[model samples]
Every structure is written in structure tokens, then in C-alpha cells.
Target: MADDDDLLGELLRFKLEAAGHDVTIVEDGQSALQAARSGKHDLMVLDSMMPVLSGPQVLRALTEEGSALPVVMLTARKGQDDVLDALSAGARDYLTKPFIPDELVARVNTILKNEGNRVASADH
Candidate 1:
């Protein structure tokens, strides 16, 4: 996860780790991009309004590099353009800030499960 907010990051890390998911928290988009280059994660939860390159900017770079790593965008901006910008830049999912932690967990689980299914089907 890439979030500028320390409290939210800690909360998410604690919850996700508790739920049997290994979590890595980065404080900014640059670190996020660098970490993702390792192709180690199954999914990324990105905060849109981050320092040193926004979430959409990172997504755009990833897309340009042909990295189809699934990304979920989190932001305080509820505007349609904000959400659309992230999606257009290659976010697989979007969430508005002040969101429920349980909901984020559910979304992450669902996305991972669906991705697993897709990979399984593709190997047939």
C-alpha cells in the first residue's frame, strides 16, 4: 500500500496483516513505483494525492511500461473526474477516502480471488 497518511497506513497494515495478508506500506508514490518494479505483489492500494508523483501518475507509468499489475486507487476526491482519471490511468479499482476498513478488506479479497480464478482458468 502507498499512502501518505501514517495512521491510515498503520491501520491498513495491521488489519491486512491480521487477516493473513502480507502487507508492505510505502509513504510515497516513488517508493511505490520502485517496489512494484520487483513484480512481487498481487495487488496495490494507492493513495491518489501522494507526494513525489501521484497515484495516477504512477499508474500511468506502469501502464506505459506494460505492467498490468492490478491497482486500487484511494482518494479524498469523490469527483467523477478524479475517479475517472485514475481509471483511465490504469487503476483496476477506486475508493474514496474516509472509507470503512472492512470494505477495503472485502475489495482486496474479492480482487485477489478473482485474479486467482483468472490465472487458473488461463492455465487450462
Candidate 2:
């Protein structure tokens, strides 16, 4: 997950780890982009606002590179425009800040499950 807020980052990290996920927390969008491009993670929980590169910018970059990495956009921008922008940019899911931890985990798990299924089918 990429979030500058230390508390929120740690909180989500704890929750995700508890649910059997190997989580990596990055403080900025640049690191988030690097992490995504490295192909070390199965999915990404990205914050829309960050220093260096914003989440939408990262999405655009990855799309240009033909990356199929699944990205879950987590941001405080509750505006419809922001949501549409991120979704249109290719985010697998858009979640606003102050989200319910359990719900976020459930959503992440669902996305990962679906992605795994898609990959499995593609390999056949």
C-alpha cells in the first residue's frame, strides 16, 4: 500500500497481515510506481494523492507500459470526478478514505481472487 500517513499505513498493514497477506507499505507514489513495475506484488492499494507521482499518473504510466497489474485506488478524494478519473485510468477498484477496514480487506480479497481466476483461465 502507498500512503504518506504513518498511522493509516500501519493500521492497514496490520489488518492485511493479520488476514494472511504479505504487505509492503510505501510512503510515496514514486515508490508505489517502482514497486508495481518491479512485479513483486500481486496487487496494489494506491493512494490517489502523493508526492512525486500521483496515483492517476502512476496508473497512466502503467497502462502505457501495457501492464496488467491490478491497482486498488485508496484516496480521500470523494468527488465523483476523482472517482471516475481513477476508474477510467484503469484502477481495479476505487476506495475512499475513512473506509471500513474489514470492508477494504474483503474488497481486496475479492479482487485478488478474481484476478487469480483470470490468470488461471488465461494460462489454459
Best by lDDT: 2
TM-score of 1: 0.96
Each model's TM-score? 0.96, 0.96
Tens-digit lDDT track for model 2 on 1-124?
Answer: 9888999999999999999999999988899989999999999999888989998888899988988989999899999999998888889999998899889999999999999999899999
- By summed lDDT, the worst window of 10 consecutive residues in model 2 runs over 48-57
lDDT per residue (tens digit) for residues 22-97 in model 1: 9999989999999788899999999888999888888998999999788999889899998888888888889998
> Which residues of candidate 1, in runs, are more than 4 Å off?
none
- The CA lDDT of each predicted structure is 0.91, 0.91
Candidate no. 2 TM-score:
0.96
Question: Which segments of candidate 2 are over 4 A away from where they belong?
Answer: none
**Predicted structure 1: lDDT:** 0.91
Cα deviation of 98 in candidate 1 (Å)?
0.9
Clashing pairs in 2: none
Error of 2 at 32 (Å): 0.7
